[model samples]
Target: MTTTSGNTNPASVQLSAQAFRDVIGRFASGVTVITTCSGGRNFGTTASAVTSLTDDPPMLLICLNKSSTSAHAIRESGTFAVNVLAEDHVQLAGRFASKLPDKFEGMAFEKDGNGSPLLVGAIAHLVCSVSEQVEAGTHYVFLARVEDAVAYPGHPLAYFRGAFGRMQMAPDASVLREVRERIITTVNEVDQAIDLDRWAAELAVGVDLVHRALIALVSEGLVRREAGQFVIAPVPESIIFESYTAKLAIELGVAESTVGRVSQGQLTQLRQYMEATFEFIKDDRFTDPEAWIQANERFHEYMVELAGSKILLDTYRRLGLPGLNARTINRSTYATAELLNDHRKLVEAYENKDLGAVVEVLREHADRPRQLRARERELFGRA
Candidate 1:
């Protein structure tokens, strides 16, 4: 498991190429297609071993297999362009990764300042002139000084464990929902400015995905853009009061619309959520507010789902009630016993098929967040 002077130690366990590849595959990498032009011919290959070597003069390096046409073209032409692929470039990545005679046969690409082909729709394009080329084992590491670069805001194509993929948040509804939930939860937990890049790195998602989620939050009034940065929108007392007022109206309407219509399956799901919430409460596990918030949301979401009104549920979501609830709970110093009791009453009313009791409990539940208005105002301080 050790190497000395480029040689594996005799006593250490050595790994085959496939074993090394498998182990390194756990380190996810962004996919890029390295393109170079030589003698009026285009050559390209999918690459992942690209890195930013320096930032002062802006330089990068890409390691290419010595036998690849791109490596030969870059060495001959002294220029290459690194086109960082987007999530939608899976087919293009496959084409370049193949041994196709002319990878750019039917492909459309624009030449960079260095006469290197830059693929369209790439998240970034870096045109470079090869400054140094060192042969390492079976590959040539080309150290290039970036002549020009352009970046587009988009999710990146990713490679992991021998498969081409994209970051999980974009285009996946369930993943996006979870991302959105986590973002809101984080915002609730912190009073400082939200950093999209930091959150993306921590969540193992693309910054573009965080930006998209923030934009969705903006539409819901949970986040606001200021100075080109996303921040949690301040929740004033009046807004909190107004939010609960609206929730009371909506949930009462939902209760009337569903009542006896809720199925045993839906009831069973709601009961499961209740059990989870009570278990967390019984164990006094409030250290992770995000978990409690998610459990609470699930309980309410099941109630909304029982109503079977997509329009109503969508409208409620658009109001950003989840974010509002998080803000309320996190800011308040009050005990959650009352809130837990309200939930128990809500479930009981639903089980008994009592429309009046359901409406009453929903009203009480809606009113609870309003009690946190003073604390929210103190924390957020005037809008």
Candidate 2:
């Protein structure tokens, strides 16, 4: 939208087109070229004005000039496919932007469920059914409901004004370590999503560091590369439970410190961990001893983080046998109701700040479970 009359405010002033272009070019945005075919004909063009609109009803918005032939076809047919371009598709980007009569000439592509033509080997692709078309000035903005999508692993292609750029991928170990350190700082210190460029600059590193970090995650199966975007793998419920139980055990010790000795800073961290662990799951009372074991694991993880004792956390981690056995027990045994009751008692003790109660509760919560399970097995004639 544009409103050009004159600068109305004392502080507001207009810049020349050259200066304006230079200023706007500083912004780096992902490049997406939308394509569609109806009645056996292909049409597409490069565009950068694309963004996510909503999640409830999977939507995205893209703007095109009303005069573009693709816009007419999209409006008439009510279907289009969005191809998210990677840095490697610079040639495709240039080819599509031209007024060539046969844009699809010798180009490889596939049709999705909606019968929409999608460019093959793209970073990612989405086939959508047009939902709404709004006329804004000289451009027609189309909001579409995503019908199907697929993504591949690679670096996203970026465009700034008229120039194309590729993401830096670092390979050096020291550079990667530095990048991770800066990433941690940004995540903890900032409330907003930290800009990757600014973060790298602050660390005196290149964008390669960020790229390498993503590559490492992808290689380890900790993340996925699709359509030129990096996606974090979902944490499994078992893992979540294990982490919580471990945290709770760590925090139990910290909670035992005298009231006055527990400084305001430590108290803040302790409460945060407790509240975070509490709200993680919808159900606090697990169904069985194994489920309880998982819950216990997650609960203790938060506790450990709040304990503020790196030595304790590291020493505990080094005892691989304990953790390995704990995990084995979680997957093999079915938890009983009594185990959950013990967990509730432990949390109550910690919340009350009763040092003796906390210690007693934790001891039983940890050691009594195996005892109870073994008693039940013996009674049932397992031995």
Candidate 3:
């Protein structure tokens, strides 16, 4: 291939190998271990440069470094199996990529139709016979005709930017947190029912993960399981009153503990969060209730963080006060201007290090949600 500069001579425009690898590393690829049996011994090496060439005759291609032992074995036997690694097979991928004398030592595998060793528990496997091999630079590009293929259900192992990783199917703590926050925001801020399947689809996570998160929320008293479906638990007037009461108690402690101790750095961070919240709330620019909920949470979380007590923060979080308040607020009835004004007062109180004023602002902030819930209860009667 000629460069765009019309340089047909390869030496005329030399590129550093590390630079080339770094650029191409941006293209993520699935991890695979190419295995072959020759002279009654199994040989394998981890590779990422594999692709399907066509479907008519089932052709695939794999590029192997010329110096690799697996490449020599494939040349000798003319057959190899491509074992696509799953997320759980990171150790196996490492073993194959190393210069271990026996890559498959004590490993469980089965022979394919072409007598090539296929790693057990791989996400997929492809048995192939080498149809053509062309030497290209320091690697050999082998064109193989697929003899057989098999696939199993699992997330694939991936390589990108010079590190091995996996596509996550099961929700991690971050995913669970996100799902939890969205559930509370939707149920309270948007005043909507929880839709498990819709949330799963929107978050690109398994339904099971969403179910697990809902179970956690249920334990936190933010949700309840009924008739094989998860829903927001009924908020009695007393419970709503108790929630705000708890918030005032907990947050007042936070403000008192952090009052004189808050550093300039913490204050600046809090100010930035308030600015973000103001920007979002201005002119009702935030169409999504979740965005507004997040900004509000950030502002409050910083206050709690400044309190510098893990036990206190944990206690506050376990109460699920934010979620409760979200459920209580009827956006249609509650004035955004009033809410913004509450936040403004709170920020000013913090800036002045006035503990009494901060406590007063938090009480008012806490009371609004209760009032909204009371209004809701008066109108709707009950859940």
Candidate with top TM-score is 3
Tens digit per residue, CA lDDT, model 2, 75-117: 8778989999988999899988888998888988888776667
lDDT of each: 0.78, 0.64, 0.79
* Per-model TM-score versus the true fold: 0.47, 0.44, 0.50
Q: Write the residue-wise lDDT of candidate 1 on 1-383 in tens digits.
A: 53322456666566678777878898999999999999999899999999999998899999999889889999999999999999989999999999999888878789987788988889999999999999999999999999999999998999999898867553345445655556554444443557877888977878777777777666666567778887776555565678668767878888898888788888788888986776444332244565777887788777877778889888777556667556655422343566788888888888899999988888877777665444445765733
The lDDT of model 1 is 0.78
Tens-place lDDT per residue, model 3, 122-186, is 99999999999999999999999998999998889989999989664444676678776565544
Candidate 1, residue 187: CA error in Å?
A: 23
Error of 2 at 118 (Å): 0.6
As a TM-score, model 3 comes out at 0.50
**Candidate 2 TM-score over all chains jointly:** 0.44
